[model samples]
Target: MLAVLEKVSFLLKMKVAQGFQTQIAGFYIYLGLMPSWSTRGL
Candidate 1:
């Protein structure tokens, strides 16, 4: 039971980390595109 719980926790942590990384990447991409968007009046 302990081993199963640990495995589940690890998987959950990995998923959370991946989601955080994706969010960070998206934020940077948005920031990088902002200048061009403003220039184009979008």
Candidate 2:
């Protein structure tokens, strides 16, 4: 699963490098989908 996230992040980075404006959008979406918030002790 972590590998998958890394792959997705890499792809997103590639798109951003190509001048896509969705970089931060994709990052926030990724953050929202990540499970760390539920598992971590705040």
Candidate 3:
């Protein structure tokens, strides 16, 4: 039971990390694709 709980927590952490990475990557991609637009908006 403890092991299963640990595994679930670990998977959740991994998913959160993956989500953060993807969001950061998407932000970079957006900047790369439209630097001027981003700059202007910012």
What are the C-alpha RMSDs, in order, of all predicted structures? Answer: 3.6, 13.7, 1.8
Q: Each candidate's lDDT (Cα)?
A: 0.91, 0.79, 0.93
- Runs of candidate 1 with Cα error greater than 4 angstroms are 36-42
**lDDT ranking from best candidate downward:** 3, 1, 2
Highest TM-score against the true fold, candidate: 1
lDDT of 1 at 42: 46
TM, every model: 0.82, 0.44, 0.77
**lDDT per residue (tens digit) for residues 1-42 in model 2:** 999999999999887776655777787787778799664653
Candidate 3: tens digits of C-alpha lDDT, residues 1-42: 999999999999999999999999998888888868667888
Best by lDDT: 3
Show where candidate 3 strays beyond 4 Å.
36-42
Pairing residues by index, what is the TM-score of model 3? 0.77
Global CA lDDT computed for model 1: 0.91
* CA lDDT, candidate 3, residue 2: 100
Error of 1 at 27 (Å): 0.2
How big is the positional error of residue 25 in model 1, measured in Å on the Cα after superposition?
0.2
